[model samples]
Target: MKKRFVIWTAGIYILYVLVMGAYLFWWADFGVPEAYEGTGADPATFMTDRQLELSQDYSRYQSMLYFLGLPLEWIIYLGVLVFGVSRLFRDFGERVSRFTFINIPIYVLLLSTLTWVLTFPLDYARRTLSVNYGIGTQSFTGWMRDQLISFWIGTLIMAMLITVLYVLIRRFQKRWWLYAWMLMIPFMIFMMYIQPVVIDPLYNDFSRLSNPQLEEKILAMAEQADIPAERVYEVNMSEKTNAMNAYVNGIGSNLRIVLWDTTLNKLDESEVLFIMAHEIGHYVKNHLLWMLAGSIAVTFGGLYVGYRIFHVVINRWGNTWKVKGVTDVASLPALLLIFSLLSFIANPVELAVSRNAEKSADEYAIEMTQDREAAVGSFQQLTVTALSDVNPPALVKYLRYGHPTMMERITMLESYQQ
Candidate 1:
């Protein structure tokens, strides 16, 4: 018997991914090492013996944890459609059919449940490595509870989206994709605005900034940036992770600059000031808003392309996959499969835009603070602490990096001689 075309196509894509990853990591194009990116000097002299050991260990473990599942995540997700696993869930969705409202939820719930189950092993392994590396302190039960909470939230969103999606498909089968894209614009913005308040707190405890001195410095930056001083907040991340980070997230009243507790405890005052300035740069330049626009563009394009391919796909494999039409809940896997591929293809464009914004933010930070020393010191400390890839391969930077590499940031900072 001849094998299915999707089976062949999926296998080909998997091989392509493996080959591409191998070439990027090993053979095709290399990046300048951080040491070489600077003035001619012994890289060994840059780090103390102890610093070298810890930095290498951190990089080794972090690299393993970060990149290990890049291929497997897509492989398993696509394999479900290529094999018949998706149809199994779709079959169950059909069997559980009831009122439109309950039926859509049932379909979403089953699809999500299967995805979560299949990917749980990767999630668990990553969490285990984090705990082993002293990166995460949350207990297994606590972790599982967080996962359940996230799963519930995701299922809820998908249920609503899927229900509306099918409704659009049934009502306007020809132009459903455009209507879906239009609906997503406002819905996405609303979600971004509300996420910090409603969804974020379910996982971490957030409070008004407590450190009087640090709060003062943060507010001063906010004043210069013209962001409201009241927007500064802090999260108790020490209970969960040892990593240090701060970000300006959300929109409007939901908007705030959040500092991780680990950052406060670990970084010096000057370093924190620089970090805050960088985040403030984001707010000053309205980066979050711009990125939201970027996201919408990517979504619109992905949906359009997915919509084009979806009908052709269903026409070919609809019966085999138990999918009747675009309106059918069983078509969820086909929809997701095409969207995921479009997303993967569009990632480089998304990341390139992000990296440029980050570089611009770095410049804005220096301009805001007028403290080049503090800014450079902050990057040096962050690089060692996070074991950041100072010089990941060129392809990796193009495809995966959202921020300029540590060396790139530091190299640019050196231009601001006092």
Candidate 2:
């Protein structure tokens, strides 16, 4: 059984390599259209020699850590099952409370804490690299505080999800996946509905956009776009990082436009308006609904596939792993491992869809604002401030980027003006 787990791990790596190679050597081979070729606003022109070098170095190092960390995480899940660590966790949880509901949270917290500890080195290394690059602003103590907050929040969510999942698994057996999927539809919507008002406030302070003039302009634009938003909100993010960002979040009444203070402070009025227009473009095009629909569809497929594979693996090795059945809290690692693999497989597809939606929004922003210069400047500023790779490797763009690359966006904007 342990040998089989090793083989499965090897197979996952092989799949990752094959997918990466295909993107690098084949799918990513296409060139920019000739119409966009003469854009004098090349990425090279946006940054000094030192800035360009720093950007490339940062990207390369970050990419390496990301790629390495993902597989290491999978292995941690595998290790728990193979080494009976998950069973020990389950036993400890049972000792803490006989009630399955109570025990589930205990087990989840234990697992979460273990993973958190094990993964801390990687997380800390990433943070250290960011700090060295002058991108991360949090103090070491503050960073750890955030990590603790994340752990508790994550544990609470995981516990609730696992408690419900096991209940459905026990009650519905083979059909548990369908029931879970059905329940998830509402839960996802509820999370989206509350995130802007509830979950987001935990991390940063949000208030109505301070610049009344800018807020009025944004609201007027939103009204023109038929957005329901009455006012724009700005979050205090400068204390956390220097990177600028803005987005539209939530659903229905909870739906609102949020700007990071970093964005408001760094960008000129025109660039900021263009950014807001791009966010408004998302609402105008109903991209959120579209994305939600896509997620529901992909999740349906993934959960169903994971359900099938979970049963097969459990049937073969349940006893060996000391996991009594799918209902066993000890079986959590198996479920997570299966889902993690599936999620990794689905990531590129998800990111590709997101890229297309973002491109559409970019076009809409340009159409709405009719200010190509502002759009171009915003993208350039974003790239510079974030130290983002303007033209990252094809594999990175395909697998990692959820939006069009900075270079791609600028080129399109420059071409649009022509």
Clashes of 2: 0
Instruction: Return the lDDT, model 2, position 142.
Output: 78
lDDT of 2 by residue, 312-333 (tens): 9999989888899888889999
TM-score of each: 0.88, 0.92
Candidate 1 stretches with Cα past 4 Å from truth are 1-68, 71-74
Q: List ranges where model 2 is wrong by over 4 Å.
A: 1-41
User: What's the TM for model 1?
Assistant: 0.88
lDDT of 1 by residue, 1-418 (tens): 1265557756876777667656644564333455554431222335555655555555444544455555555655556666767667666666776677777778788778878898788799878877875667888999999999999999999999998998888899789999999999999899999988898999999998878778987897788678875746889988888778899888887787899988888778887888898898888888998988988887888878888898998888777665677778777777886787787788888888889899998998888777877887777666555545566666656766899987678778877756
All candidates' lDDT scores? 0.76, 0.86
Query: What are the clash counts of all predictions, listed in order?
Result: 0, 0
Top-TM-score structure, candidate number: 2
C-alpha lDDT of candidate 2 relative to the true structure: 0.86
